[model samples]
Target chain A: MNGSVLSARTLRNLLPALSLLVLLAAIFYLQPRAISYVGFNLMLNLAIPIAFATIAQMCVITVNDLDLSIGTYVGFVACIGATLLSGGIGALPFIKDLQASGALPATLPWIMNTPLAGVLVLLMGIGVYALLGALIHLRNLPSIVVTLGMSFVWLGLSVLVLPVPGGQAPGWIKSLMTLKTPFIPFPIIAAVVIAVAAHILIMKTSYGAVLRGAGGNPKAIERAGWSLLKVKMAMFALAGFFGMLAGLSLVGLTTSGDANIALRYTLLSIAGVILGGGEFVGGRISPIGAVIGAATLTLAGSFLSFMRIPPDWQIGAQGAILIIVLALRTLIDRAEKRR
Target chain B: MNAEPGFIRRLVAKPWLWAYVAAAAVWLVTILFTGGRGGGEVLTAAFTFATFSVIVGIGQLYVVTLGPGNVDLSIPATITLAGAVATKVMDTQDGLILVGLIVALACGVAVGCFNYALIIILRIPPIIATLSSSFLIQSTAIAYGRGIRIKPPAALADFTTAQVLGMPVLALCVIALAAVMEIVLRRTVYGRWVTAIGQNMRAARLAGVNVGRTRFTAYVMSAVFAGLCGYLLSGFSGGSSLSMGEEYLLTSIALVVIGGSSVAGGYSNVPGLWGAALFLFLVVTMLNTYGFGAGLRYLSTGLIIIAVIVAASARKATR
Candidate 1:
């Protein structure tokens, strides 16, 4: 009985990865050349940023919160990389767009040339996210409401900074995205590294347990002398850090910046978390599962097209998968309880 | 008898009062900026525009009042889909408006049913489920419309443009609906059941309320309302496109939340819904007159939503 129970736990943990492999195999069999290295590189190229964003979202969920602004926040961070850090503070034709009177002085080219400005603005955004955490905790504001509001602000700010989609990524980021390895593509390597890193930090550590416990039972954790507020701030900051990584990597990959680009990441990352077996109000999350989950969705997004179904039906099909998987999860839990 | 303080406390407690204040502020700005000349005309136009939002806002309020984190993200997409369904049903034929309306409602019910399945049977979170359904409806809408261009019927357009007593006829119809809903919410067992379920779901369930069904019907009603708006907007704007109903998602939420309906559920103010909707319309118009671009408009609207909702949050926290 002990051995069977252990195996059951192990199977539950590895389910997401196994499903992803099966999906990959099916794609390869359906399109033989899809097994090649170049094919995977092309297919999973965008998955890296998506994985990072999913991790960011997972961090927020670790504390039983949601960041509806994740997509727009990443877009804002990309604007910072593509504009402010790339050049002056107000450099993106803001003046040209202003037809009436007052304009911001454009005499700060020297200050804008350095990378520090980008770093500072990114820090400022993280700080804002931390403030949101504080406000949510103190005021009992719903994270969804706050983050939804923040999404508009971030998207609007992105447009204000850039005003258009044209911008240049810094030298380091461009090179980082293009880094080639012997047998594996850089994105695959990066995804593995991110997954391992997040797994170690979130799943295999004492602090991580404490962090997740705060989500599960905050009052009990507080009784045990843990400051829920600090944990909340740390999770949000971690989300901010990964969101910045997602934005930078996206800019490097696309080699351009558009405010509207990466808008899909919000819902995409949410689905990734759900696919990975995360829950809405619990600290129940898996980093490796999330990474695999992102990859699975990236491939599954095209499966309907493979079946000769209209591309329009693909989105509905995704919703169906989500509902089915969730139902399956519910069934699995019920069976476990019965056992 | 120091009832003055009691009255003051009561006034402060009404979440809907703030919405009226915000609307008044917007009206004051319009008067100041537009030199009081186009006040009647601008208000007439704003009223017409807000009438479209009210239809969506009422349904949104029901779903929102279902408690914390319960939102219907599928409404905008439903509107888009319903618009296409409306036009397709009409097929430029005369005297088929009722048939078109019925078809549009059927489309909404379909989407709402899907949302119900995801939330009830599957145990999916309401937000993510609705969001997923949103994308599904959006993609299907795109396919159905075949690149987002469908001309609305002329008869419907004529009705929407028709005015009664210096106000759009549609506005009066919506006000009548709100009045009816007000009565239902105040004097009916169904309304009490909804509020009780929203206030305390587990407790209500233990008390023998059908929590799932109540919430399900709310989603259904919201979709049907959005369907009505979509068909109307297709006529008002001369056509339906991929993004025709997109803006309503955020704006509808803004109206509902600002009107003092608690995001945490168990509270609603229907009159404030109309006020907040009109206020938002005027805000967009006033900003346009002030030469503020889309960025500023987005920024301000976002700030107001956060401000009003956060205040509600803060007040609830204190309680």
Candidate 2:
């Protein structure tokens, strides 16, 4: 009985990777050229940003909170990186007016033109997220409602920064994202590094255990003399940090962003987390699994295109895939119970 | 906490009252900017637009009142699909209006059933299930309609757009519907069971509340309301468009929260839905009146919502 239960758990853990491989196999079988390294790079490149977003979402789920604002937050960050850090793409109209009126410096300072400024802005965003966590905790407010409202704030900020969709990413960031990695694709390396690093940080560290504990049993953590507030703030801050990374990576690849650029990421990240076997409650999460799940979701879109399905039906197919995956999990759970 | 204040104080203490207060304040601000110019027209427009939001908000409130993690995220897709199917069925014939409405409701019923199956049979979380189902439903709408924008029947359109003494007739009828729903919520056994389940599911189950059936009913009712709103909205707007239901996704959830319903569940505020819906519309109008840019408008809208939530929560805490 114990062995059977262990095997079931192992199967559950491997399901994300298995599904990813299945998708890849399907793509390869349909389009033989996709087996090449160049084709793999093309297919998986977008998965890098999605993986980062998935990790960010995993951080929030680790604390048993949902972030409806993450997509907009990422778009906001991308807008900041592209407009301000990239040295005023086309010079924002309002900023130009302000400068002409001597209300601002004629030229942006050297610091404002650098990646460091973008980093500072992203850190400030993290602070805001931490503050949100504090507010949610102190006020006993639902995270969903708070985050839903915050989504508009982020979107507004994005529009204020970029106004229009066109902007240039900083050259260095673009180069780094498109770096010619030897043999394997750059995206694959980055994804692996992200997955391993996050797995180590969250699944192996002592404080990570405490963070998960905060969600799994807040009263127990409190009894153990841990500050639930601090744990929550840390989780939210981590989410913000990863979300910013996602934005940076996305802008690096696309070289531009708009207010609505990453809106779909909100749903995609949630789906990735669930696809990777993370539960909504109980603080059960897997960093590597989430990364794999993100890759799978990205690949699923590619698989549909390869299948020559209509663009209209592709989104519905993705939804059907999600339902089918979850349904499969249900069957496995039932089988385990029957044992 | 023990001492009872005057009747006015008690009325003020009701959570739903603050939504009305906020709506009035926002309306006052907007009219003040115009020096009362076109204030009546603005209110009339607010009534017309807010009716759709209120219909959806009521459904969302019931679902939210079903406890934590229970929300119907498929509403927007259901609305879009219903509008598309209804318009296609009506085919601009006044005689087939009833058939179109029925077809719309049938779409809702099917969607609601599919959503519940994912939730109960597959044991998927309601949030994920509704979200994924919405994607499927939206795709179906896109495929079936192919972005077609067919006009509604003349009679249906006229009914939706009709006015009486500067007030929307549709709005008045909806208000009547809301009143009936409020009574059902407060006085009916089913309503109490929903509240009980939200308050404590296990306890309610032990007390023989038929939790599954009640939950099924709530989800179905929510989808049905979305369908009705879609049928009406497409007529009011002249035709159904794919993006028509997009804004309602957030508006439905936001109105419920702003209306002073407990997000944690076990509470329902029917009157507050109208107040919140009206407030939301007026806030947008107020921003537009001030000639604020879209960015600033969105920013202030977000800030105002956060402020309201904070204030409402503070009031609840004090009580």
Candidate 3:
């Protein structure tokens, strides 16, 4: 009896992933040439930023809150990073003088030219997002409205920084992202590390338990003398950090900053989180499940592209799939609750 | 003798009065900044904003009042599809305008019914249900139109262009619609039922209200107005495109929220919504005139919404 129950639980958990694998296999069989190793790598590469954004989205949603500014934050970080790298901030003259005086390496002409610069850009993103988070928590505002508003603010800032898309990513950065080392790609490693860290943080820590308890019953949490604001702020900060990571990964992939790169990711990430078995009312999430879900979505896009579907039609198809997934999840949830 | 404060309270609680005051402020600000861009142009823009606001506002108001975490994310898709269908059908014959309107309304009703089936029969949460429906709507629209643009009929165009006492025909229509909606909401059994459901579904059900039916009806009413808005917009603009309805989705929700409606549902202030609509229009116009660009427009609008919601929350916290 115990063995059967364990098997059923395992089957329940594996259902979504199994379906994804089947779909991938069918696609591969139908289009053998298109489903090459290189194509798979490309799919994984493209899915990296989306997966990161989805993880960020998952963090907020785990608290029973939505962060509508995920896309805008990604856009802001990318544009700012690009602009800083390109000397778009009118610091070219200073950098040139410094280069001539041997104060900076002649080989590296980029502004703030180093891997350390990436850290700064990421910090800036966190700072801005944290400020917004503070406002939301301190003012006791709804996360959706506040985040949506911040998205606009971030978009505007991004436009002001880099009105058009054009920037060269550093060679090292590009190579680090694109080149596969031994058994796995760097991005996959990074994703695994981040996912594991996040999973541990949420599942194994006292803070994680508090966050879950608070989300499940806010009044109870408050009665227990916990600061809801602190928990929310931390979640928002973590989300922002992930958003920066996503933006940086996107920069590495595209080698440029396009204002619209992050737009669809916002909604898609939310869908991905839900698909990964993340509860809307806030609870535990399986990071591996989320990564698989992200892969499934990316594969679906590639499959549609392989079928020669029009761009607009592809968008429509994605939207339809999102709806269908939600409907299915809802149905399944209702059934389980009934049982 | 002791009811003086009560009378004062009633007067102060009047939402229409607040809406008018807000509208006046927006108009005053526009006039001061534009520095006389010709009264005709100002009036034209204001009329356009008012008409658009009324339609979108009505759709949002219904959803917000439906309770149970109900929100129509698919409203924009519905609007876009309705506009496309209206324009396509009306182009064959001027008389087909009526047919187009009926068809659009019917489509809206069908979509609403589908949502109801998902939410009630399938027992999906309202948020997920509406969001899914929105996706289906977008997909259907895309498959059917493939980003195609359709031109409006002459009769509909003329109707949109016509003016009454120096005001646009669309503006007059919007006012009439608002008045009718206000009356329906305040003095009808449907309105009472909606309020009850929004407050507490269990309590409403216990009191003998058909909870499912009320919720369904609310969505249908919301969708119908959304369709009407879409049709009017297409006629007024002289054409319909694939993304025509996308912009209104966020705007409608923002306006409804700014109008002081709780996201959780129950109490709704129609006048507050009108006020929010006026404020949004003014902000957009200002951004345009100042050369703030589309990016800035998006940013500022979002920021303002956040600010307003935050302020409201702060007030609640204080209370």
Candidate 4:
């Protein structure tokens, strides 16, 4: 392996990240103004939520599981946070705007401003995710079917919490989203931090070895005196935790909550995970790749809007990119194996 | 396991039994609560919707039978795209209905081929491949339907309700289609090839089963059936909308799983899909008739599905 020439093994690792840079360069070429600090934030502000959601999805994928309801569950957590941030249930929602504190009487006053309630709900959501893990493992059910059913449940719950999409996030979260500095955009900083933190936990740590082993070959890991159930539960709990963060960040960005606002995240996250050099049934995954993958997709979502392409074909353009990238990866793998 | 169902034969060996039990319970509960008033109409409505689900379920059943770790999340998007394309092609012309329907089926075949290329050629995971395709399909659907207001052709409406012997003709047609599928799945050479491949891919390949081709056909069939369902749905829905086919995605999978099809592949209870679809629709109708809240309906639907999965798995694990 010459210093200047990248070997095939390293090329496969670098391909996904390099692809992201190429996309950015192309954006600069076509729309220089879109690469500006203000432009980047505005375009990628929504992407932070997706990035976190992708990480959430990646957690499950690392364990050879898929979370079909990532978006819905995140939305559920966000709605809960939104409802609590509303301060209090002022009155019955049906009677008036529900913002009207004077509409109804004799109702048990519920405090919506309590961060403690938010914590409890977060725990509850995590519990649900863990339960899904148990169900999939103990029940021998398919993760796709279980999560698909759970999505409807989470969607229904989110709707019940916020009949209409209107709520303010916690003050700190709102500030976090708004923080500005004289240097690079906050989204870049946030994306880097998330990617690095996840990489360390998933790729560098000793326990991370166990987690990967659990997915890569469960029987071997079990033979080494590790409980598959515990590892899987941890993976799912991490996924749920990250899902909540995605939802909270989304609410922070939008300053509102709609049960269905994050619906697109479901597919986006799955796509992001795969695009990031992650496998479906293997323990193979890359945290840094997942972040870049999310960013790539987030930008792809707006490619048409930025290029003045018809909004109608915007979706098709994305599919084409995904197909091309995947095909490229396959070709690379074949070439690498042949040598 | 099918070789000898000596013990636990009643449960895992036959998923149809579970569907039958569920269907019976749902009907019994519906009649008990509705007091028999409008029972016939209710049954008709439930079965009609169930027919739509059954068509989609049949496609999904085929795909899921491909093997473990394989699924097609793109069906919802395909269905939506089909509706959009077919309706736009018809452009309110009753005579062009056949043309529109054919085009819809072709799109599905195209999508299926694309999925196969992604999974087989590119070696991408089925979940990601289908999902990406879905995104593409959905965007195309959105663009195609952006400004066009759909008016489901008059002939389609008539086709949906054209009755024979006082029974909804669409329902009977769906039954016949299911029968045809059952034959193709159980009696055909292709069917046996798929089953052998699913049971053990390497062994099937060793036996010269043309595993790739069989798997490819299964996915293509899935997309085509889903496309047909979408075209019919647009007619029943009176037009296409952005989210018209979203609900069918999960429900179709649920129907097949509950019908006793193995999510891991190799085995499927074809008619059990019909029972699962019927039971699911009946449960929703029963809940509605009882004035259950929307939240309760969704919650109960989820819980029941979970319960079924749990029960089925319990039997599976014991074996």
The count of residue-pair clashes in candidate 3 stands at 3
Question: Relative to the true interface, what fraction of contacts does candidate 4 keep?
Answer: 0.64
Q: Whole-model lDDT for model 1 versus the true structure?
A: 0.82
Q: Label model 2 with its docking quality class.
A: medium
lDDT of 1 by residue, B106-137 (tens): 99888889888878776777888898788778
Which regions of candidate 2 are displaced past 4 Å? Answer: A88-90, A97-116, B1-5
Candidate 2 displacement at residue A19 in angstroms? 1.3
Q: What alpha-carbon RMSD in Å does predicted model 1 have with respect to the real structure?
A: 2.8
In model 1 chain B, the worst 10-residue window by lDDT is B146-155
Give me the TM-scores for chain A across all models, comma-separated: 0.91, 0.94, 0.83, 0.92
**DockQ-based class of model 1:** medium
Angstrom error of the Cα, residue B55, model 2: value is 1.0
Model 1 regions more than 4 Å off: A1-8, A95-109, A308-310, B1-12, B317-319
Task: Determine which window of 10 residues in candidate 4 chain A has minimal summed lDDT.
Answer: A86-95
Name the lDDT value of residue B252 in candidate 4.
Answer: 82
Error of 4 at A257 (Å): 1.3
lDDT of 2 by residue, B130-182 (tens): 98999899999888888588999999999999999999999999999889888
Candidate that scores best on lDDT: 2
Clashing pairs in 2: none
Q: Each prediction's TM-score against the native?
A: 0.94, 0.96, 0.89, 0.94
Assess each model's interface with DockQ, reporting 2 decimals per model: 0.60, 0.77, 0.49, 0.64
